[model samples]
Target chain A: LAKTTQPISMDSYEGQEVNITCSHNNIATNDYITWYQQFPSQGPRFIIQGYKTKVTNEVASLFIPADRKSSTLSLPRVSLSDTAVYYCLVAGGSYIPTFGRGTSLIVHP
Target chain B: GAGVSQSPRYKVAKRGQDVALRCDPISGHVSLFWYQQALGQGPEFLTYFQNEAQLDKSGLPSDRFFAERPEGSVSTLKIQRTQQEDSAVYLCASSPPLAGASNEQFFGPGTRLTVL
Candidate 1:
């Protein structure tokens, strides 16, 4: 399992872009960076996933550096309703995926 | 037929009591998983099943925890002798588990168990 580290919390104003970065120094070659968002009392929802470079979806975008040691999740045009906990998981190998401590992004109006 | 569903959205149990949390994954999903999440912490994997066959259960905290997927569509996680520390949300997720592919797992709303 690749251990990941991310900020404990972050703040963003509505309409602004927020980027949360996660570091996984021991990430494997086949590992892909995936992000999930969790609101209180609910299970985490898939946000975006990427193997390399850039990947964008209707909800968010994922940017992976050339080294793959770290990746960033960029939420465009943040809103107060976007306040939630974000998790970054490096998934690969036959090992079951594990979610580590995630970053809490509070989008303020 | 719809998204994943879990029964008994909230469960309150006494110490040493037994509890069962159920999960209904999406139709024809080949992979099923159980997870336990403590307050203010990320969820931890508990066990996994592939097409009704138990695969990895090393994540189960102890013998008190048991899970089964008899029909490959629904799964149940039973915890015996519940302890106060067992108070947490129990989550279920499912995926296609396609070989040579990294599949996305859809998660259910989870059963919140409060061991009083």
Candidate 2:
């Protein structure tokens, strides 16, 4: 099972692009990196997912290097409402998809 | 379309009390999952069901924690003799059966269980 590690917390100004990186050095070959955003009192929402290279959606972009050991979640032009916890998960291994403490992003205006 | 919905929104139970949490997944969803999220922690996978069959339940903390999806759409997670350690937000998620693709799981607002 691969374990993910990320910054405990981060602060960014509004209207700036925010990038949070997660490291999963022991990720397996079949594991795919997925990112989720969670707000207070709600469940986590899927942000972006990718296996290699980059994957972008309307909300965010996920950049995964070739080695697949690390991935970055980029939120363009973050707003105060973007403040939340972001989790990076490595799925597809024998272990169930688990979540770490995640990086708490605080977007300040 | 309606996303996953959990019943009661919040639950407060005394220690040793039994409580049942409900989940209604999106229509036609083939997969359902349950998770436990404690304060200042990320959600932890509890169990997973593919339609009517429960495929994985290794994450269940103990025998007191039980879950069932009899008809394949609605699920119920029952905690017997609840402990303070079980106090947390119980989340339910579902994903479509996208063959060979890693389908994104949609989550519910979750039922916050506070065992005092």
TM-score of each: 0.97, 0.96
Q: Which stretches of candidate 2 lie over 4 Å from their true place?
A: B99-101
**B26-87 per-residue lDDT for model 1 (tens digits):** 98889998999999999999998998899899999999999999988889999999999999
iRMS (Å) per candidate: 2.1, 2.4
Query: In order, what are the TM-scores of chain A for the candidates?
Result: 0.96, 0.97
Q: What tens digits encode model 2's per-residue C-alpha lDDT throughout A30-107?
A: 888889999999999988889999999999999999999999999999999999999999887553777899999999
Per-residue accuracy of model 2 over B1-116 as CA lDDT, tens digit each: 57999998999999999999999999999989999999999999899998989988998999999999999999999999999999999999998875122558899999999999
Residue range with the least summed lDDT across 10 consecutive positions in model 1 chain B: B96-105
Q: What DockQ would candidate 2 receive versus the native complex?
A: 0.60
Best by lDDT: 2
